[model samples]
Target: MAEDNFEAAPGGFIPGPISSGRGGSGSTARTANSNTLLSEQDVALAAPQADAVPPVIQTLRLQAEATTGVTRGSVSGGTTTTTPVVVSLANASTSDRPNADAADGDAYVDFGGLNGNFNAGSGEYLQWSFAVPAAGTYDLAFGYAFFSASATNRPMRLEVNGKIWDRLFDFTNTGANTTYSEAVTRVYLEAGTQTVRLTATGFSGPNLDYLEIRSADPHRIVIQAEDLLPAATNTTATTVNREITLPFLNGKTPAETFRVGAEGDAYLDWGSEANTLDIPVTATVAGTYSVTITYANGGTTGRPLTLTYLDGTAIGTFALAPTTAPTAYPAFYGDLVPAVRPADGSDAGDVPDQSGWEGWTKSTLTVNVTLNAGTTVLRLSGAGGAQHRQVRVRAGGGVQARAGRPIRHHARQSHGGREPVRRRDRPCHRHRRRFRCAHHRGLRGCEPQHPLRGR
Candidate 1:
């Protein structure tokens, strides 16, 4: 689920937004087929609030109904407009623009008084051009339709500023000729004249109702603890042969006996040569980022973990300060139950508090590194016993490192991006899932909370 809630074009919410491509109208009677577009309720529910802090404003929103400085063929009539109209605009060519009618009914009923027509084998498309005031990040929201007998599974390609951003579907045919499905996602943009196009990719292309583009909020990139793939271990087995040293092992508590984050109740291998953890990482954009690593040291002194890039570039080895070090078997309280999936199941919201999360004391260490834009693994070799938490990269303002609470575990994927600035200043978690940036699915802790009431 994306942070931005998708609004149905005119009717109420349509489950999953896809009509069976199998074309089975005979199987069941379609209900409410007359409402082709989203209802007023959906539009109101989907509206993003203006940030009370900074008052976020839309860079551009093009509605097909009225004159908004858009190129139109001005052609009238005909149920389907297959002819391509070439209307030159600021930064795009209307050479492939779709045929349109000013009449309002059926497919055109709620789509701002008019709608662009697309169908199978129609090379035609619809586009709107805008002058980008500045370069940063923006969220592209499309209100569209194509859910009908022929529109099911219609494939459409979204091209922004001449680059194919994605290929999407008009989805399940609603069997209703007038319905439109809406979707919202984030994209990176360089400041300039930008053209956004919804061109036909295959049969029964979708209709374009409206499009909204707004500057994205500042955000961070996080590497979840559990998602890290082990690069190398000190032993094919156990380090320093803790199995053999019965006397030393039996007398002292081992960090492995404790369950932390994802490593529940399993023994953490520790010895001069037994302890080493490595995780693969990649940076999409080259920039200086503040790196923070969280860990729990059961011992009285700080545990030293040497850090280095895959290429052997020393990222500066540092000691994890002693915090919650376990003293005995089952040292920490509470079991490491499965991570709780958030209410939205996207995990793109406030970090949920764990029931028995506080096991051992946890602490953090910080370092700054300007990484090259590509894939590389960071290795951590501890000279003593310690538990590893997740790592994160923060840009612009700083978010305090969470010590005792659980953190969101995002997948191991690198996206080249600069942090997004929030449009409004509201409590983070309140609007936690409100708006997401390019990091939509994979936000800070997967996603940090923020208010986005930009209307």
Candidate 2:
């Protein structure tokens, strides 16, 4: 019998059965030839093309198998099965996954077996990519779950073009199976493809799952109070009040007028007047007054308005203006009093005398008369004893008087053979030699002469 030998080709080795040391039979030779033929065919198929490049495999797919509760690259000789997760990219600009080359069905690569304890503590995460359609604002949102752990500190962040868009979730000491959600405002995305990634950082426990993206719009302003009038100041004594025009007559404009009537005892009278021009004024005392006009865009714009008084007299018209918003034309007024001060000495009669002497009562009056420094005379009268009344005089300081006592001299018929004499205390005593007493027709001719008879 002849022996059969087979040589392996450069592409793959050919399998052959063990033979006895003696020569083989016809069946063994045929089997050896068959192996050799198959090897040769494989080598020919693998040879380089005219371009000197090996043939390219268009698609490649692989599935993970579970063994002993663990999935590995190597598997034992046993039956293996896998489920397919199909993913289709429509407007998607980018993606990050294994076996992305597979087109459909079981050709898709399987992500290795996921354990039940995947979360922050495991420091594990899955990432994906997306493309921005255009250069405009867009809103983005993300959702995922983490596993429970003693210190599950899982946090997720979003990045666009390698820049952190936002941090989605941050949790410490999370339970075994918890889910978290994150949302962000509308951001400006530039034109062209953008690399959007969802990263799980600070997670020390387990794995994360599931992420998605979508679109949104910007905000607007609808209400404004800029047209409302402000407060005005008045310097007049007369009550001159005005009304403010409603910038928005449709009633959508929110405005309030705070007028402190006039300073002293003044009050804001907001009756049923629709505008500032229509407000009626009651009588006010003569003085400088101020009216403060306060207006608002309600609570919307929160802008303050000012009420201004025009130039000239204090009794001019008032206008409403705002730092921002539409201008308003309201009523105005002028200062009540003229600015001039009255002149002094205008009326001589009105002037008061600053210098004058004051008088005392006559009952408290005293008289004082002094002779030369060497002599003085003091007189006492109205009380005396004599034939008639006589004035007494006192002298002091080296002066003397002829009459020491009270004396009287009068003319009368002789009594007891005494001759009639003139009374020295008579009113005519000083001129005794000038005149004599007259006799009345009676029993006695002349009695004691009295000073009361004359004068």
Candidate 3:
């Protein structure tokens, strides 16, 4: 009956033999029977091998019936019954918790709600890590949009790998709804995973955006405006007056001419020929004129030409030479000279002293006469009549002399008897003798008076 009951309990029963004996034999048979029973029990309690492990059994229990929907059920024995929830696997991290609906043998991580906000005067920043296929150049792109209307007042800058990589955008002046997208190519990336970060330095509002990176061709040329004229380092030159002849690169040609001054009273004129041209400039006031010239090959050159008034006389014929082309002609001519007459006590020329003086052509006489600190007189008169010629005399270095009036001095004594006689007791008077009697008396044959006057 026990065997039948044990076999009927859904598991197979163990077989046992009935034994009869006395004393030592009975004890031995009893020990053997006990061992058999223990062995059977041990066989039933032993854990199954991995290959013979039974499939997990799941039992569903209906907890409550919904009034207008399907009945809710609870599952046990390593099975789960819950609503399916999708989670992002790309951004999963080890510190995250698994979702409630995660099943056995399935990997999962918990991700909170996506919440991002940037405040005024605060910049938007992003960080990410990725793996690279190989060592080569990569293209990086960043796309951004304003979150709120207040974000329009902020300025934005993009930084990659702690280096600025795009043009800055001022949100205040660049409009509210403006979208910013930038792309930088030829960024060298290694053959492993790298962490890229985008930092907004100057943004001052709710300005946040997304960043994208990729690979692209590494070979390309970039041209900048400053690179066009690298050889044209000096943009200024000092020149006398407003005239300047700029020596350019051998094959360079002029395109346009421009002049800037304090007032619009300045102008610039270029030569008609192609190469080796002259620029004639004019300005009303003395100042630095910014001159810019555009070349024929779409390049430009700039220089400064100082314009000033002609102050001194410059004499001599200056000729312009022709180079590869005809020589450029001058636009204007000027001369600086005095326009006045002589001053007081100046020299005057007198009448002709010889026959050749009648037809003699008067050559300009420039006499630099220095006087002592005191007053002095210089007489000058034309060799002919007073009305025949005019005289001009100047004082100082470059100042012209004004017209002067002539004055005459009358003599109180005649040319004859100019010397007076001297006496021993009369205080040595100045003598005025009309003639010497020694030579004239002998010519007239007058007898000489003897030493003794009494005879």
Best by TM-score: 1
lDDT of 3 by residue, 1-455 (tens): 00000000111111122122111111111111111222323322321111111122122111011122121222221112231122323333442223211212122211111133232222233344555666544444433323354443333333334443222222232233233323232244556666554333323322222334543311111111111111231232211111211222222232222111100111112222221111111111222222111111111221112111121122111111111110111111011011111111322532111111111111122223332221111221111110001111123342221122112123455648554322211221122222234443344322232221111
Best lDDT among the predictions, by candidate number:
1
Compute the lDDT for candidate 2.
0.23
Clashes of 1: 40
Off by over 4 Å in 2: 1-125, 147-153, 167-186, 204-209, 217-455
Query: Can you tell me which runs of candidate 3 are displaced by over 4 Å?
Result: 1-119, 147-157, 164-186, 205-209, 217-455
Candidate 3 has what TM-score?
0.21
Q: Which residue window of length 10 is worst by lDDT in model 2?
A: 356-365
Q: In model 2, what is the error at residue 36, expressed in angstroms?
A: 92
Each candidate structure's TM-score, on Cα atoms with residue i matched to residue i, is 0.31, 0.21, 0.21
lDDT of 1 by residue, 261-363 (tens): 2211112333445344443334444455555554445456766767665445677766666653111111111122223121223256442322222223323
lDDT of each: 0.38, 0.23, 0.22
Lowest lDDT sum, 10 consecutive residues, model 3, at: 1-10
Quote the lDDT for 326 in model 2: 12
lDDT of 2 by residue, 1-455 (tens): 00011100111111122122221121222111111221323322322111111122222111111122212221222111222122323321244232222222212212222242223221122334445545443444333223343343433344456654333223233232323323222234555655544333322212222323333210100000111112222321112221222221113223232221111111222212121221111111111222222221212222211121111112222122121211111011111111111122434642111110000000100221122222111111111100100011112233322222223345475678976554432434333432333423131323344343332
